[model samples]
Target: MSLTFDGTVLVPVADPDDGERTAAALAPYLSPSSTVLVVNVIEKAGGAPDKASVEQREEYAREIFERARGPLAERAGSVETAVLFGTDVVETIFEAAVDRNADAVVFEPREGRRFVELLTGDVARRLVKEARVPVVALPEDDG
Candidate 1:
């Protein structure tokens, strides 16, 4: 039997080709009738990035997810979207995964080398070691 899962996808852009590919891969494991929650997390501004900062960033993130939703809905059976903000990215993402009971998390790594890998230190690798659920790291496009 296929397990019901809440998909927590952390995306930077809505309608991004890479994000769509990742979602497509994830779809194979999902039930045709399963539901998914796509979460777009916005980094808190330098300071607190309080209510207003949060709102602005979250709104931007929301737009990205909103844009991605159409493709996600087409690829996956059903989908939902959310905008989240936090000072700590790792903590926020991990918490969201647990809170949503996500079967897996698909995200683009902020690289520290070569390109995307140079900025982020293998977040997907770290998550794989720490996350209770599976984590899929999508390849970053050079273009």
Candidate 2:
């Protein structure tokens, strides 16, 4: 079945390049009124880990949003950005979608082998199955 993307689109971005990839994937489906919300979730850990501070993560998120905005500005009505802290990534994304009144949720699958997916449990797969709103997953670009 064919789908049309309008209104607000909630996009959860993990990697820096995910912004560009997601923008490219969703550009075709977007309309003049479409608003893309690029979200970066800092997976919260109980103890201190070898990761950037919250401020640093927020800065990185902004950078990702800036990169995405350049490509999507011409295609979509507007592009927004957010930085969230959560323990459960999927749940956080879904919550954001609901809060933002998103028409759809778009994301890219984590690039890895089947063994890795099996070990970590694919977040994209779980999101597709559990999301209340329409979910769009861009195919992994290995090249």
Candidate 3:
């Protein structure tokens, strides 16, 4: 079967700038009838200090989505936003993709050296390995 982004696409956003870049990267794959769901996950770590409340995280997610919307509007049929609370970010992303019935999950690889990726365990790599649907990893920006 040919690869297609004709259905809903679940895109996980970390911040506004990253969201904008990811949206720009996804432009080529999107069709006029595609719906993009941009999501941000507020990682809940037990006993973590200075963690933002759910409401605060949601607000931040909204801002990121708003910024992303402008660029994605020209590419997709509709763009929506979501904020997810979870301890496991990778799991949350996968769950969201399944729950949304996404045809694909698009995201940029984490910015860091190979050592950093090895230390932190790349989420993008994990997603590609475990996601039930296709995972589209965009290239890192050179600029």
Off by over 4 Å in 1: 1-21, 24-29, 45-52, 108-119, 138-143
- How would you encode candidate 1's per-residue C-alpha lDDT over 41-120 as one tens digit per residue? 56675574355655566666655665566656755657877776666566677788778776666665543455664465
Candidates arranged by lDDT, highest first: 3, 2, 1
Output the lDDT of residue 2, model 3: 38
Greater-lDDT candidate between 2 and 3: 3
Q: After superposition, how far is residue 3 of candidate 2 from its true place, in Å?
A: 3.8
**Residue 6, candidate 1: how far off, in angstroms?**
9.1
Quick one: best TM-score, which candidate?
Answer: 2
Per-prediction RMSD in angstroms?
Answer: 4.9, 2.3, 2.4
Give me the candidate number with maximum lDDT: 3
Candidate 2 has an lDDT of 0.82
User: What lDDT score is found at residue 45 in candidate 2?
Assistant: 77
> What TM-score, computed on C-alpha atoms, does each candidate reach?
0.64, 0.87, 0.86
The candidate with the higher TM-score, 1 or 3, is 3
- Candidate 2 local lDDT, residue 11: 86
Which ten residues in a row are the worst by lDDT in model 3? Answer: 46-55
Candidate 2 TM-score to native: 0.87
lDDT of each: 0.59, 0.82, 0.84
